[model samples]
Target: MTDDSGADLAWETLYGETAYMCPGFDIQREQVRLPDGTETDFDYLSESASVVVLPFTADGEVVVIEEWRQAVKRVNRGLPAGGVEGEDVDLEATAVRELEEETGYTTDSVEHLTTVEPANGISDAVFHYFVARDCEPAGEQSLDFNESIRVETTTLDALREGIRDGDVRDGRTAMGVLYYDAFA
Candidate 1:
């Protein structure tokens, strides 16, 4: 007996771009040959990157940020998160910067938690998670031009409840907390 089953089709990305701002979206053009030997063109949206931080105090309280999301038009409770900036900025650095900028807390130790990809359908963004331990109140928050955030501290149980009740709807935050509960 002989088996001749393999992927012989090809998918070629013709063009792609970031199409919209605000809630940024990307568009892509592609050409592909189907398994049935039919050729076709397709379009897709590219993904972006995000970061999440699980900030903890010496007493074990978790630090979270409450911010108004312009796109969602609602206040969301979650960990400090932001997009990656320059090539020199690593994911851990992004987490630290965002945590400080959003919550006004600084930590000398940051440990990698886990990464999550919320939407693979349209975006290729990764949510980098970090555990910021031994956090200290540094100063007032320094938000970006579009950000309005408030910092809050909660017990792990309260955090879990918020997540279970959908009060903490941010996917990355939920994942980070869950990861902490499981491993950290």
Candidate 2:
């Protein structure tokens, strides 16, 4: 069947079930019929949208963070980011909240940069990127219990260097920085 965009390769979902449930996401398995009439089970991770904030301080320095990432078993240097909680009013609000929560930085000029599905093949994770300018230290970091974050300041050039030298391994951070630099 042709999709809204006139694509002939759209697969029709026959049925869906939760293969596993977790705190932030769920493993969803669905029986789908391909365009050519073949049926198979497709699995993917489903989660709420998230936000990434590339905040710049009043001094024009970028607000960065160093956090211990359990999945990779190392400290990751990246921008302030988090999943959109129930209390978040919107994407920009989530971005602002996450920046302040992870780095104690607050900004009045928060703008949406872009949105991307970082891992489309395996997960349905939508990340909204925002650029927060004139960020100031409003209070001490109020990180989540599972978060171990250390706040710092840096320049965009230094961040670009980190991205080039393979020091910045977080895809969301890299995408935000590169997207802002290239477009905004």
Indicate which candidate wins on TM-score. Answer: 2
Q: How many angstroms is residue 143 displaced in model 2 relative to the true structure, after the best TM-score fit? A: 1.3
C-alpha displacement of 134 in model 1, angstroms? 0.4
Write down the TM-score of every candidate.
Answer: 0.83, 0.95
lDDT of 2 by residue, 1-184 (tens): 4367845878899999999998889999999999899999999999988999999988899999999988999999998889987777778878888889899889999998899999999999999999999999999999788888989999999999999999998898899999888998
For each candidate, what is the lDDT?
0.79, 0.91
Q: Show model 2 residue runs off by greater than 4 Å.
A: 1-4
Collision pairs in model 1? 47-123, 47-124, 48-125
Candidate 2 residue-wise lDDT at 148: 89
Task: Name the 10 consecutive residues with the lowest summed lDDT in model 2.
Answer: 1-10
